[model samples]
Target: MSGKLYLKDKLVDEELDLSMMQLTEIPVKEIEQLGSKVLKLNLSHNLLTCVPANLPLLTQLTSIDLSKNQIVELPENFGQLTKLKSLDLYSNQISKLPVSFAQLKSLKFLDLKENPLVPELAKAAGPCITANDCAKGFF
Candidate 1:
């Protein structure tokens, strides 16, 4: 079955929560239907292997949660989410990030703990530090 989408604490049209679904992929078209109204998305605790490259099309998004999934790599143009702020990718399988990751200038929070990251990249990432410093010098 397709994953279910819901609004924030209250059922609204501005955010989407698709967490705890057994989804292997995100429903891009379904999410696109929200248009510019969608500003946050939660896709945690699923079976996703990869994030769709078209995800950046939802430019209005400022937060996203992809933790506890099976994602191994992000889209090459992942940096297109220029307006993004908080991102959670903890407990996933991500090893390497795209060079474009440096483009997330607005990002303020990121969670990459528990992933078997590459030594070089992991060392570059340094000790887990929350807040806006999470993606510092990530290029």
Candidate 2:
């Protein structure tokens, strides 16, 4: 059940759709090299507690799905991926978003439905908000 998908010396550019696999944690160390060029990754419906630190290496990534997990906070470098366009974070246990979220200038689609963030906080983290805002949003 631990099959790996690779491409060239690096991992495949295909989507790593591992959603709803009843996983509690992923071995990021094993996949660090694989994510270097990965474009899309699906890690939703797991029991992840934190965002993978090595994810930033995937500079070519465009989309990521992390919904229905146990993540409480995003990494400070989460916005380093300037190529990222879409992010799904619905139905998680997240209570607050990292200030770095505003660094995602290329971000277009963001899903934050059914979180514990308040309305006021959401507005503060509007599309135009800055990293200094540190407020949540209804994306």
Considering every candidate listed, which one attains the maximal lDDT?
1
Candidate 2 lDDT over 1-139, as tens digits, reads 2455333333345677767766666645555566454677788988888886666656777888899998877787887778888788877766677777777877766776667766765554454333232233433
lDDT of 1 by residue, 1-139 (tens): 1335443342256667888868789887877875777788889999999999998878778999999999999999889999998889999999999999898998877788889999997787677665546666643
Candidate 1 stretches with Cα past 4 Å from truth are 1-13, 129-139
lDDT assessment of candidate 2:
0.68
Error of 1 at 19 (Å): 0.2
TM-score quality measure for candidate 2: 0.73
